[model samples]
Every structure is written in structure tokens, then in C-alpha cells.
Target: MVERDRLIAALEDATHASSIHNSQPWRFRLVEGGVAVHLDPTVTPRTVDPVGRWALASIGAVVANLELALTSRTGRAVVTEITLGDSIPEAADLAGGAAYGEGPLAVITLGEAAETTTAMTAARLHGAIKERHTTRGPLLGGPPTEEEWAELQAAVAWAPGIQATPASEPLVRSLLSLTARAEDARQEDEDYLEEIQNWVENEAPSGTGIPRGAIGAPDAEGHVPIRDFTQTPMGSSGDGEAVFFEDPPALLVLHAASDTPVDQLRAGYAMQRAMLEATALGLGIGVLGQALEEPDSRAAVDGAAEESFGAPVVVHQILRLGHPAGTITYAATPRRPVTDLILD
Candidate 1:
């Protein structure tokens, strides 16, 4: 069994994993195997994540952090289980043991390490946990090198059922179009606008929402379709003048074998692993979640993924990577304390 203090420490770091709208919709409890992660539906956004896709991804990020931390500490870990239910009869039949319910999404079992051989990569990624912030600011210093992109691909390789591919110029253009269309559609919905307004904390960081400083300045050229979070009045532009985002935006799409609950969580884990790898390489990262939020655009994103990867895979998330334009500092987004997140 894992030590109590170690588990607590790991949980503390795991909270830093990215969540949609900064809504940390995850809960953890100590189990016989290791730790059982549950979905906290109370904080899940009803407007954006209608079916808990992104919510499960958020939990997947948490699982990534936990695995990295525990493996680094003990040099051994087996992610035993993750249950994101599939209610669709055929899908449920295909995804064995994926029962839909209030059960835990994943259980990470740990073991002692006699020597530190397998944990080298784990330790490296674990070190990047605190450094992984959602960077919406324009990333410069030119596009990441091929070596850097290769490092990210290696990270994705560890995640079974998930694949990451750099988008082509045409595909990037298509995805950007989908994002812009989705953003425009989102802004029109009163419920969606209200969700943005409610989650954006203008003055200071709260226990849950994002601060004004963290939301990056808009893209001056209007090339990147960054989500505008400063919409208290509904459709209000982000604060500060816009700047030019990196040209030929380096976009990576995380895809899965099928659009099932199991695949969604696995892709989420891969998403965090890739983020941590990018962070380790000193790369700024941003998510184009809007592209996969709307139904039509999401299907289009799926099609684009199949075209890029040369396989049948569903689009789970799109990430933007680049070097920061300058010394960019983001206001810290708050994470629920381990005490608050841990179940009794």
C-alpha cells in the first residue's frame, strides 16, 4: 500500500492539472489498491461539457500527475482501472467494464522501487507539474524544433489508445475555422456567456475561477481563435492590446481509437503527458477546446484527425505550442486543496 503522506503530496500536485473553465471536477479517495479518482459533478460545467467529455479529460490529467508522482517516488505503478461509462448498447459492449455511474474514473496502484531505472521519465514529467500553466499569451521564439516535437510524441506513446499528430497547414486552417465558428456560436448563447462571466475572476484568483491576468491578450492578427473570457457584459473583448501570435501555429491534435468514454479518459491522460513534456522543453502551451465543444465542429474535428493521422480516430483535444514571446507571467489559477478534494 502507498504511504498516506506520499498520497497526499501526490494529490496536492495532481490538482494543478488543467480543467475546462478551471473547474476542477474531480474527487479522490484512498482505496486498497492505491487511489480511486471520482468525478465531482457539482463543479462540472453544464453549458460547455454537456456529456462530461472534457470533465473526464480533466480527471485524466489528474491521473497523469498522480502516475508521474507515484512512479517517481516508488519506481513502480500500475494504473489498474478507469471507468467512464458507455450507455450506448453497442459502445458499452465494445468498451468492456466501462460501466456508467458515479464510480471512480481511475485507480492507480503503486509498488516499491528497488532501483530507479523506469522512473527517469516519470520523475522528469513530475518535476513539470507546478510549471504547467495554461499559456494563452502569444508564444514566440519561433516554432518548436523537431526534436521538441519528437519529445512530445514520445510522451503520447505512453498513453495507450491515444495518438498525437502535428496538424498540417490546411488542417490547421480548418481547425482554426472550426474554433472561430464555435466561439462565435458560443458567444450568442446566453447560458454560455453567463458561464464564461461566472468563471472569469477579474480582480484576483478565487478558489475556482480563472483570473483576468491569466487570460492572454487577444491575437492581434486574429489568426489564433483564443477564447475570450472577459465577457462579463457578454461579448466584451479581453483586456490589454492584442499581439501577433506565432505564425504557422504549431497545433497538435490528440486523438483516440474510438469516441468512447474509455478513449476520452485515455486521451486526457495523454493530453497532460504531452503538456508536461512541452513544459519540460520550455514550451508555452494553450488548448483549442472550442473546436471540440460544439457537435458539428467536433465531428469535423474528428474528420480532420482521421485525415492527419491516417487512421480512424476521434478528436479529443487540440493544443497550441510555441515559445513565449517574452517574459510572460500568468496569474495563478487556484486549485482545490487536497483536503477539499479528498473524500472521507
Candidate 2:
């Protein structure tokens, strides 16, 4: 039987994984063999993620953390089983065997921990869980070395049905432009604005949502625009004075073979692996989901993906990678305590 303390510790590590706006829309339950991850619809951003794509991805990230944590703790291989409910039920069920209500996003089973090269690699990535934070501040330093880039690519390649493509300079510019347009459109929508405002908190008692202090100062005009989580003016006014990127940082487009709930979950797993690998290599990473979250904008990116990869694929997320600019620090986003997240 899995030690109760170790299982709880792994669950805590799972909470540290990334989520949209730090919403952390997930719950966990201790099952017979391992843990079951469920989507907490109460915290899901319905306006932005009506289809639960981001929610599934978020759960996938949690699974990635759990696997790494359990493997490291017991020195065993972790196996994951995914179940898709009918029509992708909105809330977790949490009755009897179906811990997630309708159907679970994933049920991860732990194997006996063993001493192996793979386990050692997972241990290293597991160590990066706390160190890995989604960077919104300006990323500084040189681009990743070719070898480092290859490693990141390999990390994604390890997962089936997911592909990563490095964006060219022109494509990157197009993506930025598309993202800016999407952000502008979202800002104009009253419901979208209201929903976003509801999720951004200067100081959240629940320890979810984007913190004001974590908001980056606005960039000067002509630089890539980041989503303004603060709603209020937070970053530097683009006076066209400060220089941002000497060389464009690495931009990667993550795509799934098909656009299904299971595909999205797998994509999320691959994404977290890539991010953790990047963190282990001393690289900073940020995600731009504005375009992907918008229907028209997402279609544009899908077209781009088709052209870039010579096959039609669903673009799930965009990752910005580079070294950080000088010494950078920000308050960590708050997460719900394990007591609140555990169902049993």
C-alpha cells in the first residue's frame, strides 16, 4: 500500500502545477492503487474555456506532477489511465468508484519505485516543481542552445499525439499580432471583461487567481503584449524607450493530433513535461493562450499550424522560452490547501 504521508505530499506537489490564471481548477481523491484527478467546475473559467480544454490540460499537468512525485518518492514507474465521460461532464461526480462524478480526466496508478536512469531523470524534473513558475516578466539572456532546444523537443516527443514546432521570426510576429487583436477583442467584450475582472485579485483569500503583484509592468509600444491580469495599469507605459528583446526568444506551438478531450489531456501532459524540462535547463517559460482561447483567433493559429507542420493539428498552447532578465522575483500564486482539495 502507498504510504499515506507520501501520497499526501505528492498531491501537494501536484497542486503546484500551472493552471489558467492560477485558478487551479482541479481536485484529487486517493483511490485504491493511486489517485484520481477531477476537474473542479466551480473554479473553471466558463467564459474563456466553455469547452473545458484548459481544464483538461490543467488536470494533465497535475497528473504529470503526481507521476513525477510518486516515481521519485518510491522509485517506481507511474502509469496513467484516462477516461472520457459522456459529452464531457462539467463537474466532478466523486461518488463511489467514479471519483470524478461523470468520468475522470485521469486515474494514475503507481508502480513499485525502482532505481533506473528514467527514474533519476524524473527525480530531477520532480525537483523543479517548486522552481517552475510561469514567467510573465520580461525574459532576458540569450536564446536556448541547440542542444537545449533538442532536449525540449524530445520531452514533447515522448508523448503520443502531440507535436511541438518552433515558430519562425515572421510567424512569431504574426502570432503576436493575432494575440494582440484577440486581447483587444476580449477587452471590448463586456462579459469577457467582467469574467476576467472576477478572476484577477490583488489579494485573494482563497489563494487562487492572478495576483496584482505578479503582474508585469506594461511594455513600451511595439513590444509583444501580455494579458493584463491586473485590469488596472500595472506595467511600464510603452513610451518607446526601453529595449526588450535583443534576439527574439524561442517560441513554440504545441499541437495535438486531434481536438478531443483525451487529446487535450495528453497535450497538457506533454506541455508540463516541456515546461519542467525547460526549468531544469535554467530556462524561463511563459504561455500565451489569448489566441487559442478565442474562436476566430484560434482558427487563424490552426491554419498556421497546418502550414507549419504540413498537417492539420489542433494548436493548444504557445510557449515563450528564454533566460530571465537580471534578478527577477515575484510572489507565488496562492493555492488551496490539501485539506480543501481532497475529497476523501
Candidate 3:
């Protein structure tokens, strides 16, 4: 029972470590030797993530963090075989150095917990895993403190292929402008608009998808920049319109060279890791994948980011990183019960 409680706590820590549309999409079950993590395919935001790639990617982030937290505790994580029975299993007897299998679906075997895993270490990071949330509000004036930024950069060091950098002033302007342009362009596509609207409106208060209060009405004055899923009538007034900040102090972009599911998963993991590192440093990070998700917008954003960063932009997600104007509150995103997601 104690072991079950430990695994449950670890599962919550890892899932909370992931980033979605503030939509947490992971569930876990305590098995004989370990826990199995399954995706709530039914709850996925198909409108925003048509292929379930982002959802899987989010799960991958949870997997990575879970593995890290588990291993960091015991120095080794162990189990039996990875059973890909509908849902992905988190524990298995697989080696740490092995790569994921090539397929739309795969499972991983976690080794035994190493002796290095201590109560203190796990407790310290435990708080970080549970408390982290993405901040989408605006930046104020300057960049984050040198120390904080350095710490963030260091946290993602495990993710070798992904690159993270703070957006410069000119870079920020160009990215925001590009994002806005992308939104305008998306308005031209009725299907895309409908899809996005469905995701925005259908979300339960704590379930998947972006919430109405988090997104402001497009025509409202000083609207905090967010994806306009509503495609509302041009002049319609709604709660979607609210100004949180005039200009954000910093923006962070995560990019990789490869576009494989594995790489996307890696990027998601790195993004979450960096976000938690930022939270630990008293900084807020918000994801803005609107432009990155659209084809034309993707090209523009990629080209501009590539030019600025001096690297080809395989941009997976865009994040706003800065301090919030005041204490921000967030609701707990819902998760399916483990019994529902895991197969026997």
C-alpha cells in the first residue's frame, strides 16, 4: 500500500510536469510491479491536435519526467516487460540507454529504483512537479534575471536535440506579429475556425481544451494575445477580451531539427522541464502553439526564428516567459481514472 501511494504521488508529479492547453491528458494504474500510464484518447483535443501527436507528445513528457523522478530517487528504475496493452506502461525491465521502438505506439521498461533515490531529494522536487503551471500573460520590461535564465537553460540539458532561447525585443515583435497574422489567416478557413471553436467551447471547467476565461474576445481592447479559436463575429464582445499586460518581458521558443514523434516528444519534455525550472526560479511560462500549429504561420515563424537563433526552426511550441502582474490562479486539469484507461 505504501508503494502504491508512492507510485501514485510520483504519477501526479510527472503528469503535473507536462503542458497542454492547460489540459492534463494522463492517467495511471498501479500494476503488480509498477504503474501503467494510459492516454485518454477520448479526451484529446482533436481540433487542435488532429493526429493526437501533441497528446502523445504530452504523455511522452510525463513519461520522461516520471522516469527521471523515479530514477533520481532510486538511481535505477525496474519492472518486468513493457505491456502496450491499449495504454502505455510506465514500468518495465528495459535499460535506460535504449531508444523507443519505431511505431505509432510503444512501451518502455523502467529499471529498479536506485539506492540514490532519497526522501529529501524526492521531496524537494516533489513540490516543483505539483506546483508548475504555464504562464501566458505578458512580459513587463527586461529579461529574466541572469541566474534564473541560466538555471532554466541548464534544466533542459538532458534534452540534447532541442534548443531553448529567450526571445529578443525585435524577435518578440516579429513573433507576435506573425502569430497575429496567422490568426487572421486562419479566419479564412472555415473548417479550421470551426475546429478550434469546438475545442475552446467544449472544454469542461477542469477537463481538456482551453477555457473561455483564459482566452479573451478578439475585438476587446488590450486583449492578451492568445489563439482566437472562437472565430467570433468580428465585433462581438465576450470574456475573451481582457488585457493582462501591455508587453511581456520575455518569450522562449523550443525547437529541434527532427520532426519525428520521438523528437516532438523530446521537445515536449524539454519544454516542461524548462517550465518547471522557471517556476522553481519564480518565473512563469505560457505555451502559444497557435502559429506553430498552422502551416503558413509555421513557415513564417520558422523562418524568422531560424534567422534570429541561427538554427533551422523546427518550432514545436512557443512560450511566453516572464513574471505575472499579480498572483495567478489555475484550476486542476482533470484526468480519467486509472481503472478506466489501463487494460488488465
Candidate 4:
């Protein structure tokens, strides 16, 4: 009964984690020992997220919330049983990575020791979960200081499978150009435009989709590489009004050790932690995910990040970070109730 209560509370907090389009593609089942995280096969967005990269990452974010919430709520260490092993599993083990997408990515169970280290970290971050709002608009202020940057970078060290590389101005330009190309292509596709807009709710009280309040206008100067939800289905930009987005946009790329389903989840795990940390630091966060969703742009991201970091890596996620132009507290995004998200 005690375990059931902990799982219930943690699951509630975990549902607040990020997902593409607020798709809420994950489901949970109460197993004998712990709660099981499952990816609902039908929920993957065929047009926008054709490759399911964000789906895997979305599951990973949920895993992160569960880990933090379990430790934060109970103030104790928890054991997470995942498919990952001592190291990156072989290709045969990954089996093109799709093999595991339909099953539980992880099982969260109670553990013995009260490790103060993770407990403290969890307490700090878990509190920020509710405070996090994916800022889609322009961030006004400048970048982080060396100290702040280091602290923000440290959040990803929760696991060894992922590394965070801050983008230089030149690198940022190149990456954004690639991202803009993809965004342009998406804009041209009426089907994709319709699909994305469906997720963008112009009204609030959104139960499980991107609310209208959450959607911001494209950069007036077309400088930032943000996805233009403001685009209409008839192939036009929104409102004839735009704002100047911060240029050389503060960017951070998350690199995973390999391109596997497990690695994608690992990158997301770290991404969520860093996002929570950024929120704690009073930073606004945006995603340059369009760059990662296209093939050519994806390769450029991988090559540029590898050159920047001097290592072989898979580019999984990119974040644009800075102080918000407006309120840091935007409206809450849509999310299904925890009770509704659980599997029978």
C-alpha cells in the first residue's frame, strides 16, 4: 500500500514531462515490483515526427520525471531497471532500435540506500517540473555566464550516455540555416502544416495539445530557428506582426553516444534534467528540433557537434536558452490526467 502511494504520486509528477506536440504518447502499467513505462504504438505523429525520435525521447523524459519524483517525494534512492546495460548494447541487441519502442523502456522500483546525492539533486529538480514552461517565443536577454553555463551543463551529467555542447555563433548560424530549411519545407507541406496546427490550440484549458497561448509568432526578422506554429494551413505567416528574436540564439546540442532507441531516450533523460535546471536558474527554453527531424539537417547537426566536441556522437536534441522577453510563466501545456494515461 505504501509503495502504491509513492508510485501514484510519482506518476502524477512524471506526466508533466515534455512530449512532441504534447502527444502524451506514453502509458504506464502497475507491475508487481514497479511501474512500467510503455510507448503507445499508435500515438506517434506520422507527419511531423515520422522517425519517432521525439517519441523515444518523450518516453525518456517521463523516465527522468519518475526518477526525480520518486527520490524527491520519498527522499530516498530508487532503482530504475532499463534495457541499457554496462555500455551501449550491440546493433543486434538494438535490432534497429524499433524492437523496444513498443515495450517498457524502464521499470522504476524502490531501492535500499538513501543516497543523499541523488536525493538532493532530485529534490531541487523535481520541484522545477511544475514550474517548467517550454518558452516558444523570443528570449530577450543575453547568454549565461561561465559559472551559470557550467551549472547548466552539469545537469546532463546524471548519466554518462549524453553530453551537452554549447553552440558557437558560427555553428549556431549554420545549424539554424539548416533548421530554417527544414522549417520552410514543413511550411510548404499543407498536410504537415495542418497536422502541427491541430496540436496548436488557440484557446486555453487545453487538456492534451499545444495551447494557443503556448504558440508564439515567428521571429519578425526571421533570425531564430523556432518552429512557426503561427503559420496558417493556407501557406501564410501569422498576424502580419512579428518580433525580433535574439540572434546567434543561445543554443545547446545534446549528443548521445550512439543512434539507438536507448541512446535517444538517454539524451532525452539528460535534456529534461537540463531543462529543469534552466527553469531553476530563471532561464527560458526553446527547442530547435526542426533541425534534427530532417535528414540533411540532422547530418549537419551531427557533424558540426562532433567537430565542436571532438567526438563521435549522435545529435539527438538542441535547445535554445536565454531570459524570456516576457513572463517566464506561460500557460501550462495540455496533459492527460495521470489516471487516464495509465494502462489497464
Candidate 5:
């Protein structure tokens, strides 16, 4: 039987998983033998993620961390089954309203595996949980060594419905242009600005939202445009000298066979696993969600993915990978306490 205390500890670690804008939109319930991960609709970034793609992906990252934590402890692999639009009792909807268009994002069950097997599986990756952070600062260095790239490729191969394709230099340049256009479009929408502002609290006491310090200096001349969360001066890190991404940064386009909530969840699982694997390989990682957030941009990315993989797939996430410039330090983003995330 899974010990409740052990499960709680794993859940706590899972809370450290990455999310869109650090929204951290997830709730957990200790089920019969495992845990159910739900999207906290009230906290969901409706403006930026109206379809809940990013939110579902964030939930998958949490599941990845939870499973990793459990296996590290029990030496047993965890099983995750994602169900979309599964209805929940009115009383149980933490958002206090109809659940988001698609009800719960996923229900992860702890599966049976020998402790030794699980331990062996998690031994190499266990340290990445704490070490991994979404790097928004300027990325230096050339690219991942052949072996490093191979390890990253191997990490997400087990995720069933996701595909990762490295973007070529020409493709990366095109994506950077598309991302700028998408971000400019979002900037013109006042309502979208208002919604995003709510999560950019410079002095957020709850320790769950994006802090100003976490926003890296924007790279104006760089190929990709990092989201400017500091437009309002919410104590965001002051803009520094414009850094240029002269060499093509290591980029990966993550896509799914189909564009569905469940597929998005699987994409999230693959993304987090790849990020952690990159961390283990001493690579800094950042996400370019703008490229896949809006309709036009998303379609463009889909075209890029289809061309790169020679298959029809829906792009879900774009990752920027490379080594951090010099010894520049990156502060960890804040997360809500595990106590606050648990649903009774």
C-alpha cells in the first residue's frame, strides 16, 4: 500500500513543476491509492490560455514531478492516465463554477513496479527536480554536444503521444519572427493585458505568482522575443544591455499527433521530462509559448513541425535550450505551498 506520508511528500515536490507565467494552476486530491491532478479553473490564465492548453501542460509537468518523486522513494514506476472533460461533482469543483471546458486534465495512478527498478530509473534524474528552473536570461554557449542531445532525445521517447524535433537555424529564425508578431498582437489587446497583469505581482505574498525578479532582461536584437512581463514596472528586473542571440540557439518544437486536451497533457509530460533531462545535462532551458499560443502563430508552428518531422502534427510547446551566459545566477521562481494546493 502507498503510504500517505510518502505520497504527500511526493505531491509537495510535484508542486515545484513549471507552469505558464508561473500561474501554477493545479489542485491535488489523495485518491484511493494514488492522486488526482485537477486544473484549478479559478486560477487558470483565461486570457492567455482560454483553451487550457498551457494549463493542462502545466498539470502534466506536475504529474511528471510527482511520478519521479514517488519512484525515487518507492522504486516503483507511476502510471498516469489522462481523461478530458470528465465531470466532477459540483461541490468538488474547486473553481466554484462549471469546470473549465474540459473538466479534470488528468488522473495519475501509482503503478506497481519493484522498488529496485524504480530506484534505478530515478537515480540519475532525481537531482534534476530541484536543479531545474525555467531560465529566461540570455543563453550563451553554442549547442548541446551530440551525446547531450541524444540523452535529451531518450528522456522523452517514452511519452506516448508527443514528438520533439530540433528546429534548424533557418526554421528558428522564422519562428522568432512569428513569435514577435504574435506577441505584438497580444500587446494590442487590452483585455489580454489586464488578465496577464493579475499574475505579474512584484510583491505577491502568496509566493505562487511570477515575481519581478524572475523576468529576465529582454533581448531586443535576439531572434526570439521573451514575454515582457515588466511593461508595468511591477518590480521586474531592470532592462540590461540588449543581448543578441548571434548563433542559433538550440531550439526544439514539441508537437502532438492531434490537438486535444489529452494530447496537450501528454505534450506537457514530454516537455517537463525533456527540460529535466536538459538540466541533468547542464543545459539551461526557456520556453517560447508565444509561438504556439495564438491561432495564427500556432498554425505556423504546426506547418513547421509537419515539415521538420514529415508528418501532420499539432505544435504545442517551443523550447529554447543552451548554456546560461557565464556564471550568471538564476533565481528560482516562487511556488504556492503544498498545503494550499491540496484539495480536501
Candidate 6:
């Protein structure tokens, strides 16, 4: 197989990467000389990511993983471009062609992998892409070392749309508080809660939605703070369990300059880069959007009006960094089959 083909095969293995409801809301198009990706509107999660921004971000992260795998395996890559749009479902003339539906997120021209053959390093990192899982189990230990924190910050440079800020103790605490508040706000509304409940109950056969086991045990208080994937009767149901993660030593919140779909995708791309880098350093990372998932929390975190900096923090994903208690196995989350996603 060619490099791109090999990379596509690697996607099958990079299953541990995060996606919206595990919808895998992306489609790949093989061109004569390059590849294209499209969002399958039908596959999107209505309740969790209504606007599809989160799903697009997740797809972008998948794209980043694929690039890393290709570079490691072939020592070179040439992306040229990444087009994004609600329409323009397939190929288009980028040079002209009405700029091809608003605009694309990016067009990465793959380059020769470092001649020094970081292949060993890249291979290990790439392998971790599949091994990495967002564990919600209680964190047993503290944050990574100062040196380790620096490494993760450096990894953020590789992400396209993310500006990662290390959270202070106050900031971290504030986010947790915000999370609790968001959970409360969500539960208070019957319509919203019911919608979330429906999503959790359905098990998408194609491996395109969140699996029941992926949620770990539920909250002992009878609530799933995140998406509440178990709200219905679709899978093997179970009771809640006590889980907690103490004040994480280090917290990184990924932000995008804009909230557009394309920008969201870039943010996702950045997330994967940071994630694999953290994995390579033997750090455990978890992505949480509780604070950014709801409007009130979003306003609190955005801080756009305060203008601490000229830019606002969109808070695409929140990553908690620390050491793992032990190896944790995740269920096989489904994905829409490649055949179902391919465009002629």
C-alpha cells in the first residue's frame, strides 16, 4: 500500500483517539494524487454537539494522527490542502472554483520525515495513538513534573488551532466548580436531559458512537456528569460507582481563535498532537468539556469580554495530565465503516 493507504489502515488502529459521541463524523476521499475529508451530517450527534463543532474538532484530531503516522512510516507527507464546508461534499477546484465553499481549515503539504529517522520515536508515539484512552477513573496521584509539563506545552506547538494555557490552581478549581454548575444546569432542564439520555442508550452497530463500557462506572449519585450515555435501555446497563480525580497538578485548556467548524477541526488536530506527545512521555491525559459544554460555563471560561488578552478562549477540550494507576482497557467504540463513508 502507498503511504496514504498505510495511514488509512493506521486509522483502524488509532481507535483510542476521542471523537464526538464516537460518531467518527468524517469521511475520506481518495483523489488521483491526494486525499480529501468530508463531514457526514447524518453521523453527527444531535444532543452532545448540536452545531457539529465538537465533532469537527474530533475529525481534525484524527487528521493530525494520520499525518503523524504517515510521516513516521514513510518519512514524508504532502497534504497540500484541507477543505471544509457544509456543502461541497466532495472535490473542488481550490485554485479557483469560488474558493470552494466558504473556506477550508488547512492544506498541509507533507514533507520528508526527519532524515535522522525519528522513526523509532515516531513509531512509539504513533502506537500510543491507539493505546491512549480518556480514563475518567479517579486519579490516584499528582501532576507530572515541571519538566514534563514543559514537554506537553511544546507539543501544543504542533497543533493547528490550539492555544494551550497551563491552568493555575485557582483556574483549575474554578473549572471544576464550573463543571459542577454545568452539570446542574443541564439536569435542571427536562428536554435537554432527555435528549442526552437518548444518545447514551443507543449503541451504533458500526462503532460510530460512544460504547457503554467507555463511560466506566457511572456516578454513585446517579448522574453521568459528562454526556450521560446511559440514559436509555440500549446496552448492558449497570449501577453507578464512586469516582474522583483530585485537583489535577496540571491542567491544559485548548482554545481556538474562532468558533467556526474549520477552526474547531484545527483545534482537534492540535489536541491529538498534544495527546500523543503526552502519551510518549508516559503521562495520562483526559479530555473534558464540561465547563465549555454549556452556555453559562462557556461564558465563564471564554473570558472574551474581560480581554485578559486580545483573544478569547473557546475551550474546545480540557486535558488533565498525570500518571496512571495502571493499565486500563477500553471497549471497542464503533465507527461508521470506511465503505459507508467513501465518496465515489
Candidate of highest lDDT: 1
lDDT of 4 by residue, 8-64 (tens): 899999999998777777789988756889887455565776566787788888888
* Candidate with better TM-score, 1 vs 3: 1
lDDT tens per residue, model 5, 1-344 = 97888888888888878887777778888887688888776666666775567777888788888888878766677777776643333444322122443445567676777467557657667678878887777677767777777777777775787777778877787777888888778777776666556677543236667766677777756666878675532333345655666356678877777876567777888899999899888888888888677677888878876776677888888888887657657676887788887888
Predicted structure 2, TM vs. truth: 0.89
Model 6 Cα lDDT, one tens digit per residue, 39-115:
55555555555445576676677777666666666666545465674343234322112222232344444465455
Worst 10 residues of 5 by lDDT: 89-98
lDDT of each: 0.79, 0.76, 0.59, 0.77, 0.74, 0.61
Question: What's the ranking of the predictions by lDDT, best on top?
Answer: 1, 4, 2, 5, 6, 3
Task: Report residue 335 deviation for candidate 6 (angstroms).
Answer: 3.6
Best by TM-score: 1
- Runs of candidate 3 with Cα error greater than 4 angstroms are 17-19, 22-40, 68-123, 139-142, 200-207, 211-213, 216-224, 229-237, 244-248
Candidate 4: worst-modelled 10 consecutive residues by lDDT: 89-98
Task: Name every residue pair that clashes in candidate 4.
Answer: 201-212
TM-score of each: 0.91, 0.89, 0.76, 0.90, 0.89, 0.80
Task: Report the candidate with higher TM-score, 1 versus 4.
Answer: 1
| Candidate 3 RMSD to the real structure | 6.6
- Identify the runs in model 5 with alpha carbons over 4 angstroms from their true place: 85-104, 115-117, 202-205, 233-239
Window of ten residues with lowest summed lDDT in model 3: 93-102
| Model 1: per-residue Cα lDDT over 1-344, one tens digit each | 66788778888888888887887777888988688888776666667776667777888888998888877766675565676554433443121122233678788887666245557778888899999988887887777789998889889877787888888888898889889889888877888778778787432224788877788888889899899886655458565888888877889888876877777778888999999999999899989988687678899888876776677778888999988867768787777778988888
User: What's model 4's lDDT at 303?
Assistant: 88
